[model samples]
Target: MSDKEIVEPLIPASGSQKIDSATKRGRIQMILLLLVCAAPVIASYFTFYVIKPAGGKANIGELVSPVQPFPSNVIEENLVGKWTLLVARPASECKVGDDACVTLLHVMRQLRTAMGKERTRVQLVWLVTDDSVIDPEIAKSYDKELAGFTFIRMPRDLAKKQRLMTWLNADNEQSAIHLLDPRGDRMMRFKTGEGHLDFKKMVKDLEKLLKWNPTGKVGD
Candidate 1:
């Protein structure tokens, strides 16, 4: 054989491998696209990183901060189009007598209605943290709340670690609705001092967080 032919005969033949190459190239393109799409979100947050909500209370759960997404912790999963939390705490120790249940309904209604377009995707999730068979009357109150929410019960130990509750002193606290973004992380606190969780000042900050995870797009 000629020197070139002899060398070629010893070497392995190469296949087209077009599909493999295309898949790698496509993956790179997808990654780049995600980065491009997220650029605006980064810029907005960075620009307003120091800016707070219009009023007071601008911190974004700095006290509780974010949980950094450990698998051991529980996250509010998206249900239907709504994202909700089955708070392992109760709304109040007060009996659900008179029009209290109805009033609670109104509060929940307002909260949901306030979300407007997001209403369809967010809800109140009242979770009883006990194995006791709830009586029919108490169950009725739960059902009433469910009308405005996605209510259920879970073991206190398991549900209490949902992260948000850790921020709120739930030792004998009330069940407060949590506001969650499309992603499953607990990015804000809704059940704060009086009325609702204080976010008027941090609304823009939250708006940024909702759009982008503080962690990098791929790793953060």
Candidate 2:
């Protein structure tokens, strides 16, 4: 055996092997590219269809979708530009010691106080079906329990004329408290008589809303 036979000549890599390696690399790169391109779309579809995050809102009250617009009088009364808790009650029931009115007043006060400093941005307002019929004792109670609370007169005639209750989805019963965002759109309804009004829950929800809308509170 000569040196030529002893030292075998170096063989060039087989074209098929090179081709297979290149094909594997190309396939890997293509899969990576596809994943990069489709990741967002797949995630979005899963989030929208399967997760449905928006449907899991934490608010205890019924969310008033398509927030109701405020009547002109409400706007004029300065209901806008501040988060409002609208308590609708017939004037006849607002008498002092009236259990419903008393409970409502206490809850509204608690709700406001629970906001801490955010309380400044909140206002508790009463919508009376007949202000003229309001008992003096109730007025005094308002001064006591709800010192800065606002009173809006929405007599039957005025409510019908301005479509206030219609817009607010309110009735003569004062059993529900309507929540309005700073934009004056009615957003939520917490019913009282049905053991549905959770003061702590309302406070937490309002705090979240206010936190999200700090510099110019707006809501849907």
Q: lDDT of all predictions, in order shown?
A: 0.45, 0.67
- Candidate 2: the clashing residue pairs are none
Residue 217 CA displacement from its true place in model 1, Å: 21
By lDDT, who's the top model here?
Answer: 2
* Per-residue lDDT of candidate 1, residues 81-145 (tens digit): 33443344444432356353444444555554554444444456655444555445545654533
lDDT tens digits, residue span 1-220, model 2: 7767777689999999999999999999999999875443344234333553446555566666555666765334777677788887778777777787778877887887787777777888887765457777666766523555777776445545467756655544335788776666776678787577688877766666665555333221
TM-score of each: 0.46, 0.63
- Alpha carbon lDDT at 179, candidate 1: 41
List the lowest-lDDT window of 10 residues for candidate 2: 40-49
The runs of at least 3 residues in candidate 2 whose Cα sits more than 4 Å from the true structure, single-residue gaps closed, are: 1-57, 74-76, 144-146, 155-162, 170-175, 215-220
